[model samples]
Every structure is written in structure tokens, then in C-alpha cells.
Target: MTRDLLGRHRAVLPEWLALYYENPLEITHGEGRHVWDAAGNKYLDFFGGILTTMTAHALPEVAKAVSEQAGRIIHSSTLYLNRPMVELAERIAHVSGIPDARVFFTTSGTEANDTALLLATAYRRSNTILAMRNSYHGRSFSSVGITGNSGWSPTSLSPLQTLYVHGGVRTRGPYAHLDDRDFVAACVDDLRDLLGHTRAPAALIAEPIQGVGGFTFPPDGLYAAFREVLRERDVLWIADEVQTGWGRTGEHFWGWQAHAHNGPPDIVTFAKGIGNGMSVGGVVARAEIMNCLDANSISTFGGTQITMAAALANLNHALEHDLQGNARRVGGLLLERLRAVAAQVPHVREVRGRGLMLGIELTRPGTDEAAPEAAATVLEEARAGGLLIGKGGGHNTSALRVAPPMSLTVAEAEEGAAILERALRSI
Candidate 1:
């Protein structure tokens, strides 16, 4: 039955939409941190549907909110005044940390980033954008243009001229050998040199932690240093928090806060977990940048009554439960456990990340080359052990991504870590 469904999915879905494992299981239902497949096999979910199931699976609050809102109205478009929409927007603006902020909602991270690109270009009056190497933004045409990872970027033709920048990944590159302080200085020096030869760029967009690039991040304060350079040149700094926002990083509510000593980003785009599996994406920016567009604009299904209700409920539940603190405590334990397991495996190159968004890079034994085959093996073995994780990285997709829901418990973390350890040893 699962194979038949897989065949049907292949016939209808785009080929670029990849599935995990040699044989994919059809997830039928879920509750808390566990999900059941069509075959009646239960698995502990660590990936959280690519970190979108955020708080937990089958969260009663979000379900009730969606049901109650749908009974009244699912969508009324952006033409009418939507109470839930306004409420969610107000909540987002307050937490955004941008002074005099305004919010615009979209159905997904792709559209959110598309809106951000539009705002920055119009406000700065330039078509050039600077993006970090090994970064993934979104799947939209405009967002893909700024994506520096060739694996996710399908084409070079773009509406905007994008220049790839350095320092997104601290483990590999010319500056990898340097200490934290020197690394920040080197990246900034490289940015200054690049700026000297290019046209005036509208903005420099980056992910605090590169999601599809396997959770790679630079030294703390790297962006703060870059902010200083971009400020001098009048380039807007846009933080794509699609995968790292809403306290997923534990220490910071928003990933940009890691560099907040200088100031918040000029524009912040978020999605993935905010709606807890509902389609909710948005951009927050200063009123000046947000209102720079000359004509009127609206997203017909964006910020609809149903999605807003779900987002509101999910956001409230996350905050009320202090999931950020939970992620910090539980994820710290998981990270330490994984690091111990990785130490015994030569193929495990590195285990890195903060909070619940952790990664284990697989490499060819005794060499720096990526071992995608090893990653694939571990992913399959993990599934066999009744644990569902994810894999992502550069062109080879060689890193194992372990991002569970923020509400993950200490016991669940230990269980998942044990399963992952067995999977790694099998590799």
C-alpha cells in the first residue's frame, strides 16, 4: 500500500521534491513527540517535519484554534479587516525588536523572503544583493537567486544580481584555521574588499544558521562585525530566520539576537515553526523599508483567519510553556550525547549546532571529503531503529540534521540520542 502511494506521489509531485530513505513510510497520525506510519510502526520524531511541527505533533491548542476559526471563517482575504491577522501581526511586531516595525504575512518562507527582497530593493534602489556562501533561503525564484548553495539553486538566471559572500560556515574555507577573533576580522576584511569592486548593493541577506547547508554557523558576533561594514555602505541587513526563529536556538528568541549588541537586522523573514505545521510566514521591518513600495499589495491567502488563529495559539503555547528553556536544557543533553558517540566514529567529522537545531557531519574516514553514502546509511539505520531524523548539507548532503520539536523532553532526548548512537555505530 505504501509503495502504491509512493508511485502515485511520484506521478503527481515534482521530481525535485525529494523523499528520505530507500523506502519512505507514510505518516498517518501523530501525538506529542511520536508518529505512527501506515504499517502501524511507531517512531520518535526528531526532525519535526523539517522543524515545522515545532511545539509538538497534534498540539490540542492549535487544533482547537484552527477548528473553531474554520467553523466561522477560513479566509476572508486581505481586503477585509481580519481580527486574528491583526492580532498575530501585532504580536510579531512587538517581538521583532525592529524599531517602528511593520509586518507582512505570506503562506510560506519562500513568499516571505520574496516580500523582503522586494522591500529592500525598493528602499535602497538597487538590484544587487549579497548573500552568504553555503546558505539556503527559500524555493521562490527571487529567493533562490540569493541562495548561495548550488545544490538548492537550480539556475543562474535571476531578476537580481547576487554576490556570494564568506563566513557563513566556520569549519571549512580559507579562514577555518583562524581563531574566533581573527576569523571575524578576516571575513570582514574580505567583505570590505568585495564591496570596493561591486555596484551599490541593496542588501546583504543571510541565515544566522544555514539550514539546508547543514546547520553551519560562524563565530558569535560575526554578523555584528558585518553589520558595521554594511552600515557604512548603506546596505540593508536581512536575517532569514525561517529555520532558526521562535526560540528554536534556545539562547535567543530570534537567531539575529546573537548579534543584537549592535542592533536588530533591518529586515527579518520568518516561517517554518511559527504556525506549528500551519502555513504561516512573514517579514518584519522598519516602517520606512516596509512602506517604500509605491503601489498597493496584498496576499489573498496570507494572514487568513484560520492560519492566524493557528499561529496565535501555537505561538502562545510555545511561550507559555517556555519551550525555549526546554530546548536549551534538553538539547544541551542531546548535543553532549551525540558528541560522545561521534568521538568513537571516524566517519563522524563534527557534531555542531545550538539548542534543538543540531547537526552531525559525516566524512570519509581519515579524510575531509564528504561521505554522503555514510549519511544515507545512518538515516536508514535510524529509521530502522524507530527514530526519524533528517539529512542536509552542501552539494553532497552529507550532514545528519537532528532538530526535534522545541517541546522535546529530557527522556525523549535521551531515547533519540540512543537511537542515533546505534545508527552512527552501524555506519
Candidate 2:
């Protein structure tokens, strides 16, 4: 039956399509932090659907709200106001503490980022955008253009080189020495020079923690320095919190809160965990910048009835359960356990990240060189051992991205870590 199902999907889907369904396992249902495959095999999910399923898969409350909202109204054009939409926006604003900030919602993280870029450009009336190297904002044209990785740049590249400047450390090529402080200073100086040579940028966008870029946390005081530079140049700071937001960092409710002493960003974008698996993404900006947007610029499907309901329910659950506090406690335990495992495993190079958004970097036997093949083997082996994980970053895919549901318990986390340890030893 599983084979037949897989065969049908393969036959109907385009051959050119990238297949995440290859070598497939049919997961019939999920609840809490575990999923059951077609044969009734249970697997512990640690990836959290690439950090999207915050509350957990098939959360009863979220499922109930979604079903109820769908029964009444699934979607309506933004021309009319809806109670769910209004309430959800208000909830987000209240949690974020950005009073009177306008909300423009979208179905995906990429769309929210695209909308943010448009608003920034329009408000500042500038063509150029400054972005940090190794940042993963989104996959749209403008967002991709601002992405600092050439691997993401396709055959049809944007003709706006002057409009995009890559700042921060160059992680690839012979020019990779940009990791040094002097090199970072030089990059900043070059950006200032570019501002003088070209024009002041509309915005300087970056992820508080570079998620896809190997989960690399910038050097201490880097965010403050960057914020100061943007302020001096009259450029907006855009914190792309698509993956890092919603208490995953443990330090605060949002990733930007980790850098709050530097002043808040002009605009903030969120998506992944906003609805705890439901499709929802949005932008929250300062009142002045938000007022620059015209109503016509909004999305027709933004903040639809069903999405709003799900978002509100998810937000309420997070606050009521104090999931952030759980994240801090459980995440600390996971990190400590993983670090201990790293000490025992010769292949494990580093374990980095805060809260539950962690990464375990695999390396060659005796060097800092990335061992992607070994990492891939570990992931597959772990899956076969009844644990699910995800991959991210490293030129060759050496990092295992561990972003479990914030509600994961210490015992469950320990089980996942033990599976990982067994996989590593087997490899």
C-alpha cells in the first residue's frame, strides 16, 4: 500500500520537481511530538517541521480552532474586516509591544519578507539594499537577490548588482578570511564607502541568528555595531525573525529582544511558528514606517479568516503554557547533553545555538573540514532508529539542525539525543 501510494504520487508529479518524497515513508498521523508511519512505526520528531510546528503536530486546540473557522469562513478578501483577523493582529502587537504597528499578513515567510522589502524601499525611496553575507531571508526574486549566497543565485540573475551589497564575512572562496574582526571592520568600511559612492540604502536587513547559514551567531557586540551604522546612515534595520522568533531563543519573546539594548528594528518579519503549523506570516513595523504603506499595497489573502483563527489560538496557547520558559529549561538540558556527546564522538565538531534552536556540526576525523556525507549518514541512521531530524548549512551539509517543538519534555529530548548518539557511533 505504501509503495502504491508513493508510485501514484511519483507518476502524477512533475519529473523536474525536487523530490522531498523520494525514499518515502508515509506518516499517517502525528500528535504531540511523535508521528506514526504507515506500518504503525512510531518516530520521535525533533525537527519540528523545520521549526514550524511550535506547539506540536496535531495540537488539539489548534486543530479544533482551524476546523471551526473553516466551517464558518476559510478565506475572505481583505476588503472586509473579520474578527479573527483583527484579534490576531491585536494579539501579535500586544505580544511584540510595537503599539499601533500595522500588520500585513501572508501565507508564507517568503511573502512576508517580500512585502517588507517593498515597504522599506518605498518608505526610504532608495533602490539599494544592504544585507549580511550568509543570511537566508527568503526565496523570492528580491529576497533571493539580497541573499548573500551565490549557490542560491540562479541562471536568470537580477540586473541590480548596484542595488545589492553583501556585508559581513564571506564564508566561501579564497576570500573567506572575512571571519576576522579586522575583516568585518573592512567590510563595514566598504559598506560605508558604498553608501557614499552609491546612495544610502533603504534598509539593512539580517537575521538575528543566521539560520540556514550554519546557525552561525554573529560575534558579540556585532549587532549593536551594525545597528549604530544603520542609524548613522539613516537606513532601516530589518530583523528577519522568520525562524528565530517566538521564544525559540529563550532570551526573550523575539530574537530581536536579544539585541534590544541596540534599539529595536524598524521592521520585523515572522512566520514559521506564528500559527504553530498553520500558514501565517506577517510584518510588524514602527508606526512611522508602517503608515507609509497604502492600503492597496496589502495582500488580498493576507490574514485570512482561517489563518487568523489558528494564529490567535496558537498565541494564546504559547502564553498560557509559558512555552518560552519550557523552551529555556528543556533547551538548556538538550544543549548540555549534546555537548557531552560531542566530547565523546570524534566526528562531532561543534554544538551551537541557544534555546531549542540547536545545531550539531559534524567534521572530518581530525580537522575543521566539514564531513557532509557522514552527517547525511547520521541523519538517515537516526531516522531508521526511530528518531526524525533535519539538516541545514555548511557548504556540504555538515550541520544537523535540531528545532524540536518548544513543548518538548526533558525526557523526550534525552531519548532523541540518545538516538543521535547511537547513530553517530554507528556511523
Candidate 3:
């Protein structure tokens, strides 16, 4: 509604409902890689709507597909077959290389993760799930329980049945002090120890490239080792590509491809970029696992005509434009430029990430603790200067997430970086 309405609701709503920015800007419209506020001031959309709008805002094809679908038919219960849903599923499976994969659609990333968890637990008949620490899955009951962040806790959901494994800490990079071989060995050892200490787990879930946990990229060989361990234990390996999927990471269509040596995961979840800012999420699970999930295990507003049409259109657009390739080229340029900026400003701790999903971590001049306050000041200043960014990670650590549309140009990236450079200088 209105800004005043948000403020009023903040006072009366639960903390969860009020967890967003205290003073949220009212965006009126968006096109390509920018958005205009109600007052008509434009801001470069570096955050890409939390890395969801891979194709950019107000994409003509996406809008047209949604409109046509709405005019034709919007919803039909899962009781009957739907063309858009069937087509989207085929496209997803084809792109994901999970032939014979079954698709289950949902309204949001959280729902997809929730469905994965439910199916994993039921299929394995095990109560324990292993998830990486500092990783984020979703905000729903089961998904939140498995998430490593403390923010998603205290749910009414019963049994709290998940185990936590140590994610690579930010003390340095993913392989900070170790070589690839040693890192892989250590991960294998850790998984073995974790399993030895507890009951067998139904699934091991992790973000291929940590998103909310500061865009941490794991070391080479680590994923392969983890996958090996999961295979040995007959544990399902669930790759949560909610933030890194849809060619955002450049090298692959999904984040897991960045770690290709690990082989295919038992189940993979997608959202954020699937519908290019519209609401759509789905899971691609191995045929065996899909068959194991009881028929009608989940049901809701999934695979609706409007959402399916948008998803199909988005997929087609991504394939036609080779957005993944664009993500690689633009992301490399952005990272190179940001690294240069970081060098100029000693306060900038590190710049990392693949493809378009990048993060700039600002730290105290001489301390390890992130300068979140400084980051916030810079973010506000950048917004004022016409670039929109986002912050995440535990403690709201000084990590600025940069995930612009794959269609974002080199010039835009350069300009956005310059604006950010000025913001950093101001701080």
C-alpha cells in the first residue's frame, strides 16, 4: 500500500513480518537493470530483486506470456493436466540434465525447499538431515529448521530433526589455508565423523554457492568428496540452488555445475530466477526419489497457468539469449573492477563470487569483524546516488550483494561500480 501503512503494520505485526528494511522505498516500475521509485528517481538494480530477476525487469516476453496465460486460463487444480506446467517441466528437466526428473512446482523458494525436505525425510524414513552451517534454505518450518542461520528459528514445527555440519568459515576464503586435496580430505573426514557420531541422515543439503551466507564459494574438490560420502552412506545430496541457479553463476545453468566433479545431486531446487521476478519455484528430483514421494504428498498453488507460462517464457528467453554466457562475461568484468576498487579502499576486505552473484565484504580497517554499519551507510549513499544493493549474511555483516540481470551491460556494471566506489570513499 503506502509507506505509512507499512510503518503502521510494523507496530502491530509480528517480528517476522516486520523484518524487512525499516524504511522501505516504494518502487513504482522497473525495466532492464533499473527501477524507479514512486518519486521517479531511478536506481540501477544491482541486487536484481534478490537475484531473482535474471532476465531483468519488465521483460517483454515474460510480460506477454503472463498476459496471454492469464487471458487463456490462470489456474486448474493438479487433478487435471496443464500444458504450461508440462512444458515448463520438460524445459527444466532438459536444461538441468536430470532426464526422467520429476517436477513439483511451488509459489516460492521456501516452498520448494520445504517440499524437498519433506520428500527426503519421507523417502529415506530417517529423521535426521545434514545441512551446512551458515547456509540458508528457506523461511518455512522444515526448511528453516535445517537452515544454519539462527535468524530462522523458533518455529512451531515439531521434532526439529536436522543436523548441522561446519560450513567453510569466512576466516578466509573457502580453502583459506589449505590446498584442494587437503580440503577435500578434511571435508570427507568431517562428514564421516558427523555420521559416526549420529544416526544416518536422510539428506545432506547445502547451497552450491552460499548466498545469504555472504556468497562464500567452496574450495575445489570439497563437493566431490561430500558427494562421495553421501553416496557411500546412501544419503540424498540436495543442492539448494535457490540463489545460484538459472545461469546466475556464469559457468553453468545451476550452481552445482560450478562444482561439476561432484556429479549430479539426488535432488535440486530452483527459484529466484526461474520466473524472472514472478513467483515460481520447483524441484528436480531423481526419478527414483520422485517415485518414492507418495502421490499427493504436497498440494497448493503450484503449477498455475500464469506462473507456468512465466517460467516457460523465462526459460526460453534465457536459452535464446545465452544469458549464462553473458553472466560470465559481465560478472568477470564486475569482479575485476570491484577488486580494483577494493585495492584502492583498504576498508574493503574482499570481493568474491561467480557469474553475476558477487559480494563485496567491508571490514574494520584492522579488524576481522565486518563493518556492517559502514556497509549500511555506503548502501544508503549508493541508493541515493542511483544504485540499489542488498546486504546479507549473519550479523548483517558488511557484505554487499551484487546480482544484476544477466542482460546488464559492461557499461552499467562500470557505472554501478563507480557509484559504489564513491559510496565507499564517502564512508
lDDT of each: 0.94, 0.79, 0.82
Preferred candidate (lDDT higher): 2 or 3: 3
Q: Rank candidates by lDDT, best first.
A: 1, 3, 2
In candidate 2, what are the lDDT values of residues 1-427, reduced to their tens digit?
Answer: 8889878977999764443323677788899999898999999998877789998889888999999999998987688878999898887777775656767788888888887888898899886788776677778887888776555544346423324444332343333465557545665565667677767788888887777776766544455566777788788888899988889877678877766776677888999998888889999887788878666654678899998899889888988998888999999999999999889889887788888888888889798798988888888888889998877673566888888899999899999999998988876
Candidate 2 residue-wise lDDT at 327:
90
What would you estimate as the lDDT of candidate 3?
A: 0.82
Q: Candidate 3, clashing residue pairs? A: none
Cα distance off (Å), candidate 1, residue 197? 0.4
- Candidate with more favorable, higher TM-score: 1 or 3: 1
Which tens-of-lDDT digit does each residue in 1-427 have in candidate 3?
Answer: 5678677867888866533344678788999998998778898999877888889899999999999988988898677888999999988887776757888898899999988887798899997899887788888778778877676555636455777776444345344567656766766787899889887799998898888888876765566678787888789888898998888888888878756775778889988888887888889998888778666554557888898999899889988999999999999999999898888887787888888999888888877677888888888889878999888765455788888999989999999999998998888
**Count: clashes, candidate 2:** 0
Model 1 lDDT tens row, 1-427: 9999999999999998998989978999999999999999999999999999999999999999999999998998999999999999999999999999999999999899999999999999999999999999888889889999899999988999999899999999999999999999999999999999998899999999999999999999999999999999999999999999999999999998898899999999999999999999999999999999999898898999999999999999999999999888888999999999999999999999999999999999999899999999999999999999999998499999999999998899999999999999997
What are the root-mean-square deviations of the candidates from the true structure over C-alphas?
Answer: 0.7, 2.8, 2.1
Higher-lDDT candidate among 1 and 3?
A: 1
